[model samples]
Target: MSHRAALGTLAIGGNPLVSRRVLSSVGEWGGARVGARGAGLSTSMASAEELRLVARIATGDEAALRQLYARYGSLVYSIAVRVTGDRCAAEDVAQQVFIRVWERPAGFDPERGSLRTWLATLAHSRAVDHVRREQACHRREQRQLPGAPSDVEEVATSSAVAERVGRAVDALPDDQRVAVLLAYYDARTYREVAAELDIPEGTAKSRLRLGLRRIARCLEQEGLGAWT
Candidate 1:
């Protein structure tokens, strides 16, 4: 079996999969991921026995969660710090990850992707939500944030590289395009966009719907839209 495959299989099966050499390697990788989460794990190594702890996490074990935190807290913390550009926020997001893992252990679906991928996706989603919150607050500070503003910009079919994205976005109707632009670019709250655009909030939301649907249609044309 391939190296990662071995790691995955052993990890899921709760076996003594760590060879001496692999033990050293996993120790190093574990440390690195932990260090990414935060600043101070003087030695980032996991002993050979750590894999069982991780597998327990895979099985909804509480001690497994603790082991995961011990092994990877720094790593997740680091990613959160980088994304939020604030130590406190990063810590908050990282803490939330552990809470989420504990509360809904069943969310981890190996068929969807590896645990690492799922963790990272969680980090990114939290970061994005935080950014949106910040942007909304900033918009409130600035008077120009609109609800249904036209956030659509000129398609860079001006270059072939962005052609696909440009075409997809362009396929949206005027209302949806306007709604999307207003909310996404102007950073307007949906309510603001609705009021400013003289449409009901639901109508404003519908515009976004129409526009996004068109983008999905275009993305389906490329077979990559399903990644969402």
Candidate 2:
């Protein structure tokens, strides 16, 4: 297996080149299974095996990469989803973690920590970066919208304001809450929210509008509506 083949297997849906690569490479490589064996081994033995796997991956062994993913993909993905609160974003973060491993296996220094700890750290940092990027994008979008808050970060970071807003959003109907969250927190456009919820675009817009209005009314009733 070449480096291209290793990278191809790690691909989910990010780069065009990566997305175009097929899963057939897994079959071609005979799908070597190492994860289960490693799981039953002693700590030191498991670490040794993981080091060997990374060494093989550095040499373009797709089977080793697949084995590594099999061993730790769930851990990485769970951390991502817990932080990002979005399954789709979590999937992207998980793929990125594996792709980084494939491209730079040497980055995993066994001397510094166990492979599991290292992977967990990578997953956490990547998830945090994703959340920050989404927040920044959401702030920018809010700035551009008419009557939208000019400093969304200010309101969000304020404990009192955030608590109020959280309660308001929680009180929304299920459909409206989902739409509002997708648009506001997820940084998705109305059209994107519509597609995600499998609703018409007009319905998506209407839900968001109603949700925001209700939240505003709630905030105003509590004398915190001037947050914007």
TM-score of each: 0.42, 0.47
lDDT, model 1: 0.55
C-alpha displacement of 41 in model 1, angstroms?
34
lDDT of 2 by residue, 67-123 (tens): 667666655776677567776777667666777877677899977766766887888
Instruction: Give the CA lDDT, 0 to 100, for residue 116 in model 1.
Output: 51
**TM-score winner:** 2
User: Model 1, residue 155: displacement in angstroms?
Assistant: 9.8
lDDT of 2 at 207: 98
Give the winner by lDDT: 2
Residue 78's C-alpha lDDT in candidate 2?
62
Against the correct fold, how does model 2 do in TM-score? 0.47
Model 1: per-residue lDDT, tens digit, 1-228? 333433343343222232212332434233445334442222222223334454565566655665566655655665566556566666556655655665555676655644554676787667557657877678534544433223235432332323665767666766777777666544455787799788999988878777877876875677543322
Least accurate 10 contiguous residues by lDDT in model 2: 144-153
Model 2 bad stretches (over 4 Å): 1-45, 140-228
